[model samples]
Every structure is written in structure tokens, then in C-alpha cells.
Target: MPGTPYFSPRLILGAAAMFGMLLALGIHILGQRFGLDLGDLWGTPNGIIPATAAIAWWLIAAVAFVGGYVTASLLFSAASGHLPRRLQHALIAGGLLLLIAAGQAASGPSPVPTLHGFYNGIVALMLGAAMAFAGAHFALARH
Candidate 1:
């Protein structure tokens, strides 16, 4: 029964950290891709607050992690036999591909700016993949 016990907290924390890193990195990259001054967020009085940003990042990370965990858990439960592993791998790959496509789409000329959207989508995809991987690892390890 050692492996039977689900390490929910560990999985959630690990996934959240991974998601946060990816989100920060993706934000930085999108800012660079399109001419956006990250520092500008500090120009105005309420534009940027280090503490606020950190809190926002943490909130985002936690949400992404929970979402990923739930998705992976559901998928794991629904899949039969070898299907879980295969589905997990496929979902990760598909998510990456969707992220790339979304990024490309966002980069295109549009009436509304999509830089943030593209970055968020990519970060979510990355987080989802991390979650899927964590779930698969736990399931396999326990099995």
C-alpha cells in the first residue's frame, strides 16, 4: 500500500513550480518577441509592484497546477489498461503543438494585441504537460 497512497500535495506543488517557471519564461519571451517593455509595467504608479507581481505569479501558478492535476487525474481514471500512458504522452505532445499554433496565431497582425494571450496559452500548455507527466509518473510508479 506504500505506492497506493497518492502524493497529492507533492504533485500539486511540483506541478505549480514548473508551471510558474514556464509562465515567467514565456512572459519574458513574448515580451521580447514583440516590442513590449516589461519595465514599462513599473512606469505608472500602479503599473508594476514587485510584491503584486509575485503574488499574481503565485496565484497563476497555483491555478495552473490544480487544473493540470485535475485533468490528469480524470484522464488516468478514464483510460483503460495501456491507454493511460498513451493518452498522457499524446496529450502532452498535442498541448505543445497547440501552444505553438496559438503563439503563431497571436503573432499575426490583429486589431487587438495578443502578446499576453499567446504567452498565457503557451504557459498553460507547458503546465498541463508537466501535470500530465507527473500524473503518469505517479500512476506508473504506483502500478
Candidate 2:
């Protein structure tokens, strides 16, 4: 690895963020193509999310988990000297997922919370975070 150009961990994190966002979008689009109907429950009456919608959210959370896993793995491999171990990787991956979510929240107006209700966003966030944390924790596990 001598003579190889060195890159900052921040730069790697930024790239991971972009990669995670794109991965999330691609997964979402693929889900839609498969008739998942991600927005089907956007404005349901009485803030009720049916079984199908719950299933859809599960898929979304799965995608989020993959995104977080890939991004964190990429960063860990790219900057092994920076990240200490499993706990740090999990934390970093979770943070990267949150960064992706924050970027998504900032990109445009999301009517999900306003129209669908706050629980939708909360559920998505919690599921996504939990899965992402688990994914990252296992990504570098010795098995």
C-alpha cells in the first residue's frame, strides 16, 4: 500500500453519503417498479397505515439497511486506519444513515409527516436506524 495516495476520512464519508443516497433511490425505484407503491399511504384517512403499507415500509427499511451497510463497509475498507472496530463501525454507519436521511429531508419538502402523520417518519427512522446499526455491526464481523 506504499506510495498510494491518501484520502481523508471526511472525503470518504461524503462519498459514502452520496453512494448511500443513490442506493436508497435506486432501491426505492426498483421497489416501485415491482409495484410496491411506496406512496400509496401518503395521505390515507385517519393516519392509518394498512398491512401493505407496513410491508412497503419494511422494504424501505431494508433498503436503508443495505445503504448503511455498504456505505460503512466502503468507509471502513477505504480508511481502515481511522475506524477502530465493530462498535465504531456500527456508530459510524448509523450516523451515515442519519446523514443520508438528513440530506433527504433537506432536498425537498416531504409531505409524509404533514400529510401522512408524524408516526410514519418516526417509524421509518427507527426501523432504518436499527437495521443499519445491525448491518454495520455484522458487516465486519468475523464469521
Candidate 3:
């Protein structure tokens, strides 16, 4: 399978992250429907600050970690390549993801209206990127 063209790193990472995000959103909706107190990771009505922000942050972190872990694990395990090369690809993917997150934080509309919400969002984004990096690191270590 030397010549088998696997997807580029960007595609793999992006797809995994988006898929994870969607799954998290679904979970959030289900939690709401069931009257479960899952944090308001998604914005609340009237810009109200809910008590579940911490829980939401952790949820997002888990999503990001899973995304990175899956992507790296699959790519590193299936592709017949050097370990260092595979790791470099993973790093590049992580960096790209971080860039995208930063850009969104900078230019996208605020999810909440308050400064606390803004700072919390920023911290969540940073935690996401860090968790992703850690996940990829662990995945690579296993290989």
C-alpha cells in the first residue's frame, strides 16, 4: 500500500474536528431535550450567563481531544510511513486548527455579549487547541 494516497493532513484534521463539533452539538441538543443540565456551551437566550459554563468548557475540551486523537491514531496506524514524518503531519494539522480557532475568535460574532463570556470563550479555544495537541501527542506515543 505504498502508493495508496491517503488524505492530506488538513482534510483529515478538519473533517475530524467538524465531525466532533457536530457530535457535541447533537449531545447538547439531546441534553436540553431530556432536561439535563449540560452547560450552555451554546449561547443562551438574552445573553444570560448560565452556571454551566465550566461544564461546557470541559465538554468542548473533550471534543477537541477526541478529534485529535482519532485523526492521529488513524493516520499513524494505517499509513506506512516514518513515525517522525507522521508526527510532523499531525503537528501541522494541529497548528492549522489553532490558526482557524484564533481567526474565528477574532473575527466571528461573540457567542455571548459580556466580557466574561468573551474571555471564557477565548480560554475554551486555548484549552481546545492544547487538548488537541496533547491527544495527538499521546496517539503518536502509542505508535
Clashes of each: 0, 0, 0
For every model shown, what is its TM-score relative to the native structure? 0.35, 0.47, 0.45
What would the per-residue lDDT of candidate 1 be over residues 82-115, giving only the tens digit for each residue?
A: 3466767886776566457546744666432476
lDDT values for all models: 0.47, 0.57, 0.55
Instruction: Write out the backbone clash pairs for model 3.
Output: none
TM-score of 1: 0.35
lDDT of 2 by residue, 17-43 (tens): 455444444444344444554566766
Poorest stretch of ten by lDDT in candidate 3: 28-37
lDDT tens string, model 3, 1-143? 35756656555555545544433443333333333333354556878767565556566668768866776676655554544666667866775675455454445453444564455545555666666666666666675
Best by lDDT: 2
Better of 2 and 3 by TM-score: 2
lDDT of 2 at 23: 46
User: Which candidate leads in TM-score?
Assistant: 2
